[model samples]
Target: MNKSVPANVTIVDHPLVQVKLTQMRRKETISSDFRRLLKEISLLLAYEVTRDLALTEREIETPIERAMFPVLRDREPCFISILRAGNGILDGMMDLLPSARVGHVGLYRDHETLEAVEYYYKVPSDIADREVIVVDPMLATGHTAVAAIERLKKDGAKNLKFLCLLAAPEGIAEFHKGHPDVPVFTASVDKKLNEHGYIVPGLGDAGDRIYGTK
Candidate 1:
């Protein structure tokens, strides 16, 4: 069977995103610097992820002139962080969208089973009525992202988008299979996953690198 990257996937190939991504991928990069890079790149990624936020025109006064300006139609999106690594992206996104509601899903992949296991979950009561942006730095096997989205949808999150720093082809395929309606925005799609389910040529364990837990 022929395979393809999902049509809903958007690659954010902006120059700054690519450059910071390279820095984060380097083994010699210190954890502090890696965390800094992740946050910086995440802001760039968030800019693209929120590009389609609803807009409305409202009357406003600009200095000596009265005119209509395009403003957000509603509250900022509700953001769900997939876990510890997800927080790295969340911080940057919050910087960009200060009014965005924040939530956390403490989901992790079982090392041996390669399945997502959720330990914690919380979100705004109005998640169903607002757009949801799910952030995680890496999408390796995709189980984590799938599980997180499943939880959100179960909670009535109708409009959702997945944002990640890097993704593997296998991961994207798996994610699409489970949630084809949700669009994915990522800085780059790498080659493949290695035997242990790590994205090939990907930055090392995002959570570990971000928190210096390794």
Candidate 2:
């Protein structure tokens, strides 16, 4: 399989991201704590993901003097969370971009076919003109990622990005191979996927960990 992931697809290696991930990995972390850490880590990841957002200057009058103000140049980025697991990451990103538009895509892996089956999808009507960031806590198989992107592309979204908490090498390769132009941001890339398609040494099912369900 192709191991060459995008050079632009950054995996954040900050100490804080690592520390929070460690807490998230612990088996004892309860749903509440897991949810909290997911939010915090998502915010940190957002910092890197949005670093290059265009900024514009505007003149402003301060209490004492006139000054130049800087704000995001393009329309604020829209967030598209990939359902249940993605919502954990979305909560944090929303705290940072509260005014930004939000979208949802619901997908489930069909047990029999092992395919990504979409049940619901909604996005801003003006997606073609806005930058979009797709969030999901885990990118395990890349099937969902590829399918999700395909849906987004069909919706007319141009500039698109994918962000995840963790990914496996196989999944990362699959994503890149399927959509080499899209950049991905992740916290860590694990060794590989196990027999049942779980990322080995991963923090278990992210949804189960965050929601306290099996």
Candidate 1 residue pairs in clash (backbone atoms < 3 Å):
none
Candidate with maximal lDDT: 1
Pairs of colliding residues, candidate 2: none
Instruction: Give the clash count for each candidate.
Output: 0, 0
Total clashes, candidate 2? 0
For model 2, the stretches where C-alpha displacement exceeds 4 angstroms are 1-5
List model 2 lDDT by residue over 85-199, tens digit each.
9999999998888988999999987766657999999889988888899999888889999999999999898899999999888888889888888899999887888877888
Name the weakest run of 10 consecutive residues (lDDT summed) in model 2: 1-10
User: What CA root-mean-square deviation does each model show from the true structure?
Assistant: 2.1, 2.0
